[model samples]
Target: MGGERGSIVHRITKRVSQEIEEDPNLVLINKKNADQADYLIGGGITSFDTYIDREKKDNRKYCTKGVFVSIRYQLVDVKTKEIVYTEERYIDRQDTREGSAPHAIAVVSDDIDMLAKQIVDITRPHEVKVTERIYLVETKNKDFKTACKLAKKSENRRKAQELFAKVYADEGSYQTGYNSAVLLFLNRDFEKAMEEMQAIEEKFHTKEAQKALKRIQEEIEYQQKPVQETSLDSMYLRF
Candidate 1:
């Protein structure tokens, strides 16, 4: 694969080899050595954007710089020459340096390294951590308390969301409404979460409700975006 950054092609080749070496099911070899292999992986840097402070505070001195790199990759059947998988991913890194624009751009090697690792991760997926909050029941109702316990077990998220919504509707407690919103978020219902949080904020006017509303709104915006499976051509056109 090729990239606009100096030595990026070499870095990518080295990084890919390193990643393959770490996987027990994969092996890295040259094209000539792939006669017995089942699949071939290939692709290149499809888009790149590097920038130094275009606006000069004094005599063209730059205070900020960054790079955005996008790479496209695919896995194909070596025998049939049929494409099996394709992906395009983008990485952006930026920093501030009190120096000339050229000097600022020279310190982007770390960004390139990070981009290379990201590409490797796309090829070999990595494990990520997910955080889940424990919702406490404030009501004296025995049934609501039992449902909260079931919700914490994660066996039935949809049922938990519905139960919490019912509790909030019957009790009209701000805490119950907040719990319902949290369950809605866990269920991947961003719009409903936002609605619940907004209602809580408007009625209670408390700092906690306002903060929760803000977080839910941010999650809603993130879910609405089309960043996943983006294309290099579309990214370039948008930029």
Candidate 2:
């Protein structure tokens, strides 16, 4: 798990172990119990990059920061010693702010849950049917109204995300800010979503945002770990 960022591998492994278990067919086992499991998931960071920029705006300094990470990993059938699935996943995130940049450690946080869930999606042999919905927020602004409509279309959601961001920036209201962050969370941009949610709480201190922020943070934490963990046996975490 050791790589450019000393602790990143550990974080990614923990996230991956927690997420991959979401697949109904798979249960993580301690790597020490390799003989007891049917498959294994392993990976490591291939490349990582970080950058920051600052701009002076109306006597205030605004900072923009970004992180890029690439990871290579594989899923192997334990008994057959065959590579079942493998991929080199690339993820990059940029945050432009009107003030201080996000913390250095926080900036480097990549969503390994995305990579792990991607693997689960690809490896899952069967599909389970489930119902879900993406809700829209109410806004008097015409642009916000348009965004609500655009969001209903799956592919147009990024466009909607941009609009939502604009509404949040312009209004700076709790409702707009909350909706913006919620959309990012739904889009799986956990880190940025967290940043936005925290901002809402800081500015409005509303109970609704506080509760939503807690739920978002908990999800980002993966129940503080997987639903089930076998301490002595070791859960399927590999780096």
- The residue-by-residue lDDT of candidate 2 on 1-239, one tens digit each, is 24336566666666666676655566767656778777666656678787889999799888988878777665566676655444467778777777778753465564655555665554453441111233355657988888778766555666777887897788776666676787676565778988998997999897777887886776666423422321112234222
TM-scores of all candidate predictions against the true structure? 0.43, 0.47
lDDT of candidate 1 over 1-239, digit per residue (tens): 23355355456656666656676756665555566676666666676677766555766455677777666665555666554444456667677755654432245566656655554453342231113343574768765786676576444656766777787788887766777777776566778888888888899898777777776676665445433332221100000
Separately for all candidates shown, the number of backbone clashes (residues 3 or more apart, or on different chains) is: 0, 1
Clash pairs detected, candidate 2: 30-234
Residue 82 in candidate 2, Cα distance off native in Å: 1.6
Clashes of 2: 1
lDDT score for candidate 1 against the true structure: 0.59
Pairs with backbone N, CA or C atoms under 3 Å apart (clashes), candidate 1: none
Q: In model 2, which range of ten residues has the least summed lDDT?
A: 226-235
